[model samples]
Target: MGGGAWKRGGSSCRPTTTAVGEPVVLPTVTVEDVRRVGLPPSTANLQPAGGHVVLNVPVNVYAQAAPVTRQVEVLGFPVTIRATPEAFTWTFGDGGALGPTADPGAPYPAMSTTHTYTRPGTYPITLTTTYSAEYAIAGLPFQPVDGTVDVSAPAATVTAHEGTTVLVR
Candidate 1:
């Protein structure tokens, strides 16, 4: 009955709410969100634990990973995520493979995780590390996500030769 207001209930008791432009928009999460987390940088360190190893001898192979954790925003919420080295899989490149184990073999004396080469040859060793991921999103107690990702360390080269000892008189 007054300004450009619409009345309801067949009476001017209260005016209907007027449109106030478009509602504010908020960003939604997508696969691209993963890019923000990205694949973690190289974290594993792979190499032979001893200087020289003989054929049939268990050469100690070990890998280490750096600790990574950060609080990031995901789906417009604070998400705490952590990445840790879970296990390591080794490929001796000598037509043999080691383990996807959590054990990092000790030095020469103790071979916790090792491989025995049957013959003498130069080999390129590689170690692939699996990472365990844990995440907790703030305000979303029932929606927790967990997963694993793998990253490989730089390849290491090793030379293997038959054991020999010479004593001259």
Candidate 2:
């Protein structure tokens, strides 16, 4: 009897034949541990001052992976991202100025702008940004976000002291 067939007594048994292909029952791979990488942080540290206020606003563009670039439009202002240090400045009405013109370090990507209130009242403060052309990791290029803070001088307090002479004893 040939090796391809099995012989049982005088009867010959044919070899088994099976289709050659991928397995009919294959394992599946499900998505595991999904993580979000690009999402900018909203600005904070908005307070009031004497007819004016200094805002320590933090600006960042969503970037995934290394060297990811993106543009952020704040209040219809377009800001390009060459580096985190380069940021735009926004003033309220007018008569306000920015702080010292020096590198304040990096990693805390933000810009400082002083807003001077012409009168003592409340006003709306807006912040905007525009990313560079290379920046595309984020959603769009123009976005306007704003936060309001009251600007008024501290209320004044006055006191009067009374003194008595020896005749009052």
Best by TM-score: 1
Q: What is the Å distance of residue 136 in model 2 from its true position?
A: 9.3
- State TM-scores per candidate: 0.62, 0.25
lDDT of 2 at 94: 33
Question: Candidate 1: where are CA atoms >4 Å away?
Answer: 1-53, 139-146, 166-169
TM-score of structure candidate 1: 0.62
Model 2 regions more than 4 Å off: 1-44, 48-85, 91-112, 135-169
Candidate 1 lDDT over 1-110, as tens digits, reads: 11232111121212323378444222232222323465454433333443355787667776656656666664354766566767778888888887778775555566
The local lDDT score (0 to 100) that residue 108 gets in candidate 1 is: 52
> What's the CA RMSD for each of the models?
14.1, 24.6
lDDT of 2: 0.26
What is each predicted model's overall lDDT from 0 to 1?
A: 0.58, 0.26
What tens-digit string does per-residue lDDT give for candidate 2 at 62-83?
1111222334332232433322
